[model samples]
Every structure is written in structure tokens, then in C-alpha cells.
Target: MKLLEIVEQLFAQYGYLVLLIGLPLDAIALPIPPGNTTLTYTGYLAYKGVLHWLPAVLSAYAGAIIGMTVTYWIGYKFGQPLFDRYGERLLLKPVHMERTKQAYQKHGNKLLLFSFLMPGVRQFIGYATGIIRVPFRTFALYAYTGAAIWVFLFTGIGFLFGEQWKHVLIWVEQSLLYITIGLGAALAILVYVKWRKYVLQKKATARAIDR
Candidate 1:
């Protein structure tokens, strides 16, 4: 009847569902607490002998990759028009996109490999990688690597902490809140820097081309 009852039943019977449901929602930026809670709970379930660690890890990685793929497709196919109409109001600067593209271009696979760990950048880096039309095989390779590590890190933390994980969850949430704010500020600074560099480079190139 109530949602809590449903959750209790699910937790009792199928702990993996938490990973399946939570990962995608988090990836979509729904303000759901990060995937760590689902992960840690899964870890606890595994410790209680009701779940398996490998499948839990796989479920997490699969859910995140699939959710991120959807986000990437949405951004690739329709994000540009959406941006054209509302970019200015939302602070979605095109130059930030450009700079991210350039970063991917110069660093190639390295950026994708580490993108998962980077706060505030992780969620968009995958989507932007696809929107910019990075090769699928390459995207899959690096993105999966990142997702695997991401899942393992949280799952391992939960497993190691065992029953004493509530403290970890609280600390993680508070840290993430600070991280979100810091990331917003950092992104703004990055957009400004990227835009200025782009403008200067464009002017120089135009002058050279004219001569």
C-alpha cells in the first residue's frame, strides 16, 4: 500500500533492484541521493548472505552506463535546440561545451578513463562525449572502465564498513553537497576562461587568414 512497505518488501527480497532503480535516477540528475546509498545497502545485503557482490557490482555499472547512454542520446539529438532556446537563462554556456570537447580531443581516452571520479564533471562528460560524436566503441570502453571503478569504490567502502556505514553515508552526503556548490563555481570560472580563450584565438586566426 504505502511506498515504505514496497521498499521494505524489495529490500527483503531483491536488494539488486535498489541498484537498478537508483542508478538511472541519479544519472538523470533527479536530486536522488547519489547511487552510493543503494550501493552500500546492497553491500550490506551481500554481507548478510542474501546477495552476491559481483552481480551487485555489475548491476550498478550496467544501470549507470545505460542511464548515461540515454542522457547522452537526449543531449546529442535534442540538446542543441533546447540550448539555442534557453541556453542563456540556464547558464548553459556553449563555450564550456567547446572547452570540454577540446579537452577530450587533446587528451583522447585519458579524459574518459578518469571522468567518473571527477566531481560535477562525471555526469555530463559521458553525455558530452557522445553528443560530440565520439566513437561508440571507444566511449563504451572508457566509460565502462570508469563505471566499474565507480561502482567498486562505493561498494567496497560499504562492504568494508559493514554495519557501521550510516556514518559514511552522512559524511558522503555532506561532502557531496559542498562538492556540488564548488563545482558550480568552478564550472562558471571554466566557462569564462574558455570563452575568453576562444575569442582571442578566433581573432588571431581570422587576422592570419585575412593576411
Candidate 2:
């Protein structure tokens, strides 16, 4: 909770810059200030009129994007060689990397969205995606969207609950897995529906073009 107080203090002093800088650091697997607490506190500040709601959200979103991108590039540049050389000593084998790539391919990138919700995995996912060479466009489509949803959800909780937001974080941490699972299912359904629509539209366009 002292850390939570520290986050509030940082926001109080520097305003939106805290979210802008801290989030990127957090994404890069640095806890310059942790992400979840900072987001909730940002929303709380917004609720208290210390910071503008919309700008706070925007700052957090931008920061998260910057962070994820930085880590992804880091992994893209050096992760393969670094991991390959040291992984076996740590019990990680080539099959594990292959399995990761296969999983990403099978999921068609929706999995990347929810990976942001998971704490440990979230930190490393960008690196993994980069190391495995997920195409930049596909990675951006999912990663950027995921960052928006992630920032809004956590910050919104702070805005909605105000003073009670910290207490709620305890519950959130305990339930994060369930939350992630629920979010994953919802995202999967949404993706399926969108894909179905796209397929139908393509079919219709083809039929018209043929006729």
C-alpha cells in the first residue's frame, strides 16, 4: 500500500507524465512503478479532479504502446540468440520455442490480446512474439488493441470506484486468472463473429463480381 501511496504522489507531482513514463517502463519489464496500481491510481486522480480522465487514459495508452514496442524490438534484435544459448541450461529446449510459435499460429493472434492481461506472461510476451518473428502488422493489430483495452479496464476501475479502488485491486489480483479467462473467451467470440462477417462479405463480393 505504501507503493500505492508513492504512485499517487508521483501523479500528484508530475501529473500525466507518470503514466506516460512509468507504463512504458513497466511494459519493458521494469517496475519503475508497477502498471496496475499506477493505472488505478490514475483513474482515482481523475475521479478526484486532480487529472483529466480522457488525457490520463490517453497517456497510459501511449505509454503502454511505447513499452510493448520497445520490448518487442529488444527481443526481435537479441532474444533468439540469447535464449538459444542459455535456455537449455535453464531447462528450456528448442521444442519449447517451436511449441510457442505453433501456439501463436494456431490462435491467430487473439492469444496476444489476453497475454497482456497476465502479469508474468504480459511482461515477456512482446519479447517472445518478437523472438519468434510474428509479423509486425499482425502484432500491431492485436498488441495495440490489447493495450487500449487493458488501459481502459484498469483505469476505469479506479475512476468508477474512486477511493475504494485500492481495495478492489486485492480482489483483482486474486481473480486475475478468472478475469483473463473470461476476457479470452469474450475476445475469441468477438473474433469469430468478425471473421464470419468478413467471410460472408467476401463471398457476396465475389458473387457480384462474377455475375
Candidate 3:
């Protein structure tokens, strides 16, 4: 069955508990009903008055935070050993990990800040932060903020768009790619400027000492 269909039935049967339970699993990569769709549906339910808006939003956000936190710790404590020992079985080869590391070196924090909004990425980004040993303060700053935005954005879509939520999802997917590219280019330019200044400072320091 399609995920939405399955989700529909679950929501019909379980109501608020679905959000409370499903979102956390989705963060951990299980994605039983998928996070974005679920949130949108949550908004729709609130709009219909089937679920109260305040509790619905609260429950969804709490579930997402719990899932992300657990995923982060799992990566911190056990991710490396599991990858090292059983990477091939999981199809996460050593080369893949190395490339991810290099990419993260360049745009890790930027990606981390918005990772929760994207499906495949949201699942792994928490693990990446943990394995990379990002500071707890930094993780909370970016990850939790992203979660809040993600919850509000999608759920608000459902609330506002009503029956048209699916169409907006399509628009969101298309637009996000372009937005990411534009932001990435801007960040790259900023990084280049900072690097150039640092190099110039080092060169000037060396010349002065030699003189």
C-alpha cells in the first residue's frame, strides 16, 4: 500500500498517537509513515477540528525532538564501530564515509541546520553530527531549530492549503533544490573570501619576520 494510504488508516485508527509515535521513528530512518506527509496531515486534521491544533503541534514537535536526540546518541556511541565492521552489509562503504566526511568539512554546519526538512538526509544527518562529534550546544542550536521549522512549515501547509496540501509538497520539493544550490554558492564564496584573508595575513607575518 502507498504510504499515505497506510498513514490515513493509521491516523483514522490512532489519531494523535500516530504523530507521537510515527515522527520519532521517522527521524531514526524508519519513516513508518514519513515525516513531512504526516505533519501536513496533522495540520489538515487540525483544520478539520478532528485534532486540536495546540496539542497536535506540541505532540509532533516533541516526537521529532525525541527521535533526533536518540539518533544522535546512537551515532555518537556506536555508529563508527558498526560502520567499520558491517559497512558493506549496510551498503555504506568506506569510500562513501570518506566522501561524506570531506563534504561535511566544507558544508557540514549549513547542511546540519536544514537537514531535518529533507527525507533521506534528515535520517542520516543526526548520525553524521554524532559521528563527527559535534558539540552538544551546536547540535541543539541547529538540529532542534530545524525540527521546529520543519514541523511548522509542513503542518502549516496542511492547515493553510487544506485540500491542496499535496500540490504544495510538489512545489516544496522542486523549490528546495534551487534554494539549496543558491545558498551553497553563496556560502562557498564567503568561505573563499575568509580563506584568502587568512592566507594573506600568514604571508605578511612571514615576510615581516624574515625582514
Candidate 4:
């Protein structure tokens, strides 16, 4: 069957399961679009008066936090060695990893709070947090707070914009793509700038010693 047909059936028959499973799948980079499509379809259902908005929103919120928590655990467990070996060729470059490390260095625990809201930054932040051995209590505090707000905001969008949610979904997906691209470009620029500064500083130090 077609993909849309499957999405429709899943929304109709197993919306809650989608909420539960989709979150983790998306967190793990499974090519799923997180809760965007699911929430939009649920909104459509709500407009038909067949679904309750509150339950769906709450379920989605809880599911997102749980899913992110699971992903965080996986990162904590096994992400370091794998990333150290393979991150450069993939999305997580050494520079990107260093950027996240810098954020952790500057902000201490607050980077966790902001990571979820960030597009390109969150995945790396998760892994770096693990490598740095952020305490579970601190990690949960920042992660859950960010995840809660993230979930509630998106689910609330679905609940409030039930009828026109298709437009919202399209806009959100497009916006995310743009944001991710922008972030990647920005990271590249920052890496170049830092490298240049470091080279300049080394040259200055060498000149001073020569004198």
C-alpha cells in the first residue's frame, strides 16, 4: 500500500502507539519526522470530533520525553567510541563535536536545557553529554525541561490549529530543514574563524619568543 494510506491508518487505529514509538524512532534518526505528521493528522482527527485534544497532546509530550530519555541513555552507553571513530565522515564532525564541547564548557549544565530546542546541536550535545559524564540527575533536569517544552509547544500547535494544521506541518518541516542547513553553515564559519584565531595566536607567540 501507499505511504499515505499507512499514515492514515496508523493515525486512525494506533495514534497513541505512534506517539510512543515515533518519538524514540525519530530520536534515533530513523528518517521519521518526529511528531509533526502524527500531530497534524491527530489534529485533523480532532477537527472531525472523533479525537480528544488533551489526551493526544499529553501522550505526545510524555512520549517525547521518554523517547529522548531512551536516546540519551543509548548515547551515554555506547555513543562515545563509535562517534570517536566515525563521527567525522558523518553528520557529527570533529569540529562540530568540539563546538558542543565548548558549549558544555561555557554553559556547564545549561547546554542540556537548550539542546533540545536546537536543530543540529541536540544530537551532538547528547553524545558529548555522555562522554563528559554528566550526572543523571543533572542530565534529566535539563533534558526533561527542554523536552517538555518542545513537546507541549508542538502538540499545542496541533491542538489549536486543528483545521489548518496541514499548512502548519508543511511550514514546520520546511523551517526545520532551513534551520538545520543554516546551523551547519554557521558551524563551518565558526570553525574557520577559531582556526584562524588559533593560527594567529601561535604565530604571535613564535615571534615573541624569536625576539
Candidate 5:
């Protein structure tokens, strides 16, 4: 069966349970139901009066946060050893970790807020944050806020579009490639700007000290 059909069946049989459980699993990177599709479907259901908007949105938000939190803890507790043992097969090296850590430090914790909007990135950000030992409080603040916004965005789309949510999904899937490329270019520019500013500041400070 098609994933959307399966999701429809699940929602029919399980109602809110589908969102509560399915979303968390998706957040953890399981390929069952895509998170955006699920949220959009939930929104459509709300529009159809099959589900309540508040509960549907809440369930999705909670599920995403829980899944990410669990993944983060797993990464914190076991990521290093597993990577040490099996990372070569995955082409993950120590240098990659070091570079990621440096980037995280330079960008600060707020960078995680956008992880959800990036394809294939939401699944890894939680794990990476944990492996890098980011404080849980900071992780929760940004990650949870991002989750809420992401959930609302998709759900609202589904709700507003009614039966046409599928078209939106298709558009999103196609546009994701362009969006990812744009985001990558923007990030590169931001990093370059920050680096340039830092260098200029350091040069000025050095000149002052010499004087």
C-alpha cells in the first residue's frame, strides 16, 4: 500500500494514537510515515472534523520532542563508542566530529532551532547535540520550540488546504532540494561573514595592544 494510504488507515483505526506514536517514530528516523505528511494529514482531519486541532497539534509536538530527546540521550550515552568501533563503515571520522564541534561552538545553540526545517538533518541534529555534550536545557529550549513551529506549519497547511494537502506535499517534496541548496549557501555566507568580522576585530585588538 502507498504510505499515504497506510497513514489514512492508521488514522482511521487509531485516531490520535497515530500522531502520538507515529510522529515520535518518524522523528527518530523510522521510514513508516513521513513527519510532514502526518502533520498535514492530521490538519486535514481536523478540518474534516475527524480530529480536534489542538489535540492533534499537541500530540505531534509532544511526539517529536520525545523522540528527539530519546535520540539525543542515546547519542550522548553510546554514540562515541559505537562511532569509534563502526564509524569507518559509515565514513564518519574523528576529524568530522571535530569540525562539527567547532562549528557548533562558533554558531551557538540557536542553530539547532532550524534543524527541523532541513531534510535529513532533523534526525541527526539531536544525536549530534548529545554526542557533543550540549546542555539538555539548551537543547530542549531550542529543539522543542523548533518542533512546535514545524508541527504547526505542516498541520496548518493541511488544515487550510483541505483535500488538496497532497498537492502541497508534492510541492514540498520537490522544493526541498532547492530549499536545501539555498540554506546551504546561506549558511556558508553567514559563516564567512562571522569569520571575517572576528578576524578584523582580532587585528584591531592586536594593533591597540601594540600601541
Candidate 6:
């Protein structure tokens, strides 16, 4: 059977257990199933009254949190040695790691809030955070919140779309490319606006001092 077919059967038979186990595995970057699709399908099932909404959401949220937490600790404990051995192969030079660390420090923990929205990024951010030695409390706060939002957003889409959730998932996948572009543009605009304001303020201060 196809993977999706197997996933559907698992959900049909196991419901909560499948979500709890599957979501964590996905968060840990395992290749078993598509986490987002599973969550969305669960939401559709909930809409059809085959599962409870609260439990489904909670299971997904908890699973993701747990998986990420484990991955983070693994990076914390073993990242240095692994990186030292395989860093060149992965193109992860010390300079690159240092630059990433600097960026994280400058951005602060709040930057993690959007990590969940970025594919391939969410899986690594936890590991990166751990490697950088971010406090567990801060990690949990930002990461968990982001996970909750991500899980709810996809699941809610499934529930809302009912039988049409598959189309929505396809649209989401396609739109993400555009979304990334739009976000980049928006960030650039924001930076430009902020820089302009800073320049204007500096000029105003100079005028005041001359006066």
C-alpha cells in the first residue's frame, strides 16, 4: 500500500496513539510520514466525528514538543564531536557555526517563534539552539509556542475544509514558495524603514546640538 494509504489506516485504527507517536517522530526528522499531512488528516477525521478535537491537538502538540526537546538535548550533548568529525562533509565549517551563533544571539529567543513555519528549518533550529546552549526554559517557551501555533494552523485547516482538506494541503505546499519570497521582501522593507527612521533621528539630534 501507498504511504498515505497506510497512514490513513493507522489513523483509522489507532487514532490518538498514531498522532502521538507519529508527530514526535516527524519532529525528530524521521522519514516515516509527513507530519503536516497527518495532522491535517486528523483534523479532517475530527470534523467527521471519528476523533476528539482537543485530544488530537494536544497529542500533536505534545509529540512535537517532546521530539524537539530530545533532538535539542542530543545536539547539546553530542553536536560538537559530530560536527568536528563531519563538519567539512556537511559544509558546516566553524566559521559558519560561529556566524549562526552570532545571528541567534542578536535576534534573541523570540526568533524561534517562526521556526515552525519554515520547512527543514524547524528540525534544525532545535539542534542549533541546543548547540548554542540556550537555556532550557527559553527554548521550551519559544519552541513550544511555535509548535502549538503550527499544529493548530494545519489541523484547523483540515477541520475547516472537511472533505476538501487534501486540496488545501496541496495549496499550502505550493503557496509556501511564494510565502517565503513575500516574507523576504517584507523583512527587507522593515529593515529599510527602520534604518531610514534611525537616520532621520540622528539628523534631528545633530540639528538640536547645533542650535
Clashing residue pairs in candidate 5 are none
TM-score of each: 0.67, 0.77, 0.75, 0.76, 0.81, 0.78
Q: What are the clashing pairs of model 4?
A: none
lDDT of each: 0.72, 0.86, 0.86, 0.69, 0.86, 0.83
Stretches > 4 Å off in candidate 4: 1-4, 80-102, 107-111, 114-125
**10-126 in candidate 4: lDDT tens per residue?**
766776777777765655555254455665676566667777777766776777677667767777888777888887768787777677667666775765685655665555565
lDDT by residue for model 1 (1-211), tens: 6443444476677567766776777677752545656666667667767788888788888887876777667767776677677888988788966866777777767767756555565677766776676777888888778778877777776787888766886676577668767766886899799899999999999999999
Backbone clash pairs for candidate 3 read: none
Most accurate candidate by TM-score: 5
Those runs of model 3 whose alpha carbons end farther than 4 Å from true positions after fitting are 83-106, 177-211
The C-alpha stretches of model 2 lying farther than 4 A from their native spots are: 84-96, 178-211
lDDT of 1 at 104: 74
Q: TM-score order of candidates, best first?
A: 5, 6, 2, 4, 3, 1
lDDT of 3 by residue, 51-154 (tens): 99999999999988888888899898898888889988988887888877777777787777788765478898888788766777888888888889999998
Q: What lDDT score goes with residue 195 in model 5?
A: 89
Which structure is stronger by lDDT: 5 or 6?
Answer: 5
Q: Measured by C-alpha RMSD in angstroms, how accurate is candidate 5?
A: 5.1
Instruction: Looking at model 1, report the run of 10 residues with the lowest lDDT sum.
Output: 2-11
Give the residue spans of candidate 1 off by over 4 A. Answer: 1-10, 31-33, 81-100, 107-112, 118-120, 172-211
